[model samples]
Target: RHGMRLDAADQAWHLSTPTPYDPPLTYGGWNQCRALGMRIASLLDAREQESNAGSGHSDNGTKRKKKKHKVVIHTSPFLRCLQTSVAISAGMAQFEAPKDRTSSSRPRTPSQMHSASPKLPLGSQKRYRKTKLRVDAFLGEWLNPQYFDHITPPPPSSMMVATAKAELLQTEEVDTFTPTTTQRTSGGSLWNGANNRAGSSRESPLDDWSHVTNALLHAPIARRDRSNSASSVGSNESSGRKSPFRPKSPFRHGHGFQPLTSTMPKVEASTYYPPQPHYAISNSDTIPRGYISHARVNTVNVDYHWDSSRHLQEWGDGGQFGEEWSSMHRRFRRGLNGVMEWYSQHGSEERGEDALGLEQVMTHESTDDDDQEDLVVIMVTHGAGCNALIGALTNQPVLMDVGMASLTMAVRKE
Candidate 1:
């Protein structure tokens, strides 16, 4: 039943099989198959050991010739046959994955050439282009051989490195400028008047909001009329200031909606209490959905400062915009009155957690185990075929690290 036969003339066992032979791989059959392989290995090992021992002892003048008898030896011609077969299919060595030719019923789109869905390419994934581009995709920068042939000396008069390019870069830097501003302030009544009109109910903040805004609109005109009439009546009531702050906002958001910007008055830097300073955010951060931040107005100058020690204990952290700029950098620049100010001020302890919660979200998501390690060998007959197949596998990222070739090399060396 096994695929092996003896060739008496050649004095070896040769592997013989039915033309369309198929080996068993069921639970019981796999064990039998392994046992057959183990038997062949043992026979080969015994022969090699005997050959080495015989050579060492044969140096004596009285060497004994091996006994010739009518021995029914189970010489393995199968090993020689398999070695020939292996040499023929050497480059075709590969792990055969079961193919499912059936197609899925799901609709296909042009964006997806196959069933694989493309990742959203969201959040920290954007940074991979900047951080891992050299190691990942070469883009215009792969160091291949075609360009290496053109090494040349530059023209003698050229000051290439230090003088020419350096001055041009510096000139571009100093030439740019921004307009300066003078600081101004609105009366306190403008903000205080709006703040008093807090929404009465989550469903109905508009009614209460209307009362506060009405008083604000009338307050400005009332003074103008009073001042002109005061000129007629000869009194100093108009000389006094209207309320510095006002109740202004009817901040209302519900059913997954944010408060409208119209509720909050926009202040220009020149007209604000103190001029707002521009904070440079070198890192771009993505905001998690539904992160609420209480905007605690800082007493410091109008420039935003996200003070970690001072404000974050009270208000929640800033939304996507307020995350750590550089986790690698030990220092954090908190904006006291800016975007960072709003995020760290929220009180909820379990706040800002989101969909992308795992470390894999920030790292390379997959590792190919075969590409990371090697395989085990079954027989000495696998030597030549294993090398050719291994060369093919090594060239492909998908097929690499199959150490079967190394096993074949070790067998040949032995």
Candidate 2:
């Protein structure tokens, strides 16, 4: 459960609230979420210690079993949920060291040996392997397009690509500007210095670099066109066709040429300096594949909460004063069942078994002297969904308030 936080403006609108803007989590909400995560980790630690004390020691008191703790975190795609997961992960990490924290007696790698030290520092060479956090996009607010639109096409122009790269590479300065409608629609403005219909140019000052380079490259091509036209006129004058050497603009759209857009602040250059030559191919073009071809694809299934039911007009107004609550409850239970099935399947695959009960799959404990294992699953979700789930699990209506970032614990007892 997320802690106490104000709703986003969009959420407020859906709820018919007066506020029009989404509000971020208050300072208290943020702190509460962090504290809850830390508390959960502490409680788990104490429980593990108690279990070990009761089961691990032998009668002779000469031998004791060892244990390990593992935490698996799952988060909804919502920003608040993701933030909560981060807070929880930080809390859990504070209690444990990396599995490879021990240093070798002697340097294992040649690079380490080359250094003056004969042994690596503790935790210096250790690779801390924690369970990968899973983002359940399906768990996002229902009917939100953000989670569904997984494939976003890149900008079409090379100029835009270069500008984006420059922005990424030069973080010390802001090198990008919001693109105008003309820049997005008309490809010709990039090649020529012609102003759009607005009569004002929004080009970035960095475009001066590209303009100087292009002018130099175009000069030679213009000259060659002139020479060819002069020679062709004598032979083709009788045909009455336009001259080929008329020196037309070579920076046509779809010619594989990318125009540079202005983004950075203006810099003065010497008038006497020769204009820089523009290269035929841009850095983006040199890449082996197009943006769409190299787009990454991820297959994930998320389970959103029933609070998303608010999106349905029929479910609004407290689901017609609790009359529609049963429908909402059913939806939530179905989604939760799907999640449990997935966990069961995943556990089976890992253990090479046919299937495992949800409790057995989610809860892990180890008693081996060389290995200690504990598994914790943290789920971040909406208030309505959290309350409903707790009610179903405990077989009663939720009596406690579920605030933003608030936490509820359920431990399976053997």
TM-scores, all candidates, are 0.13, 0.41
RMSD of each: 34.7, 19.7
lDDT of 2 by residue, 1-414 (tens): 765444431333324433222123433454456567557767876776677667655789755655545555555444455445544554443344223445645447776567656344543432222333544422333322242243222222222223322322221221223444433334444545665333323344433335765776577532235356455654454578766644433233223334544435454321112112233323212112211111111101111121212331111211221224455455445555555555545531142221354434443333345555545566676666676668766778774557666677776444
Score candidate 2 by lDDT. Answer: 0.43
TM-score, candidate 1, is 0.13
Return the TM-score for candidate 2, rounded to 2 decimals.
Answer: 0.41
**Model 1, 303: alpha-carbon shift in Å?**
72
The ten-residue window of minimal lDDT in model 1 covers 130-139
User: In order, what lDDT does every prediction score?
Assistant: 0.25, 0.43
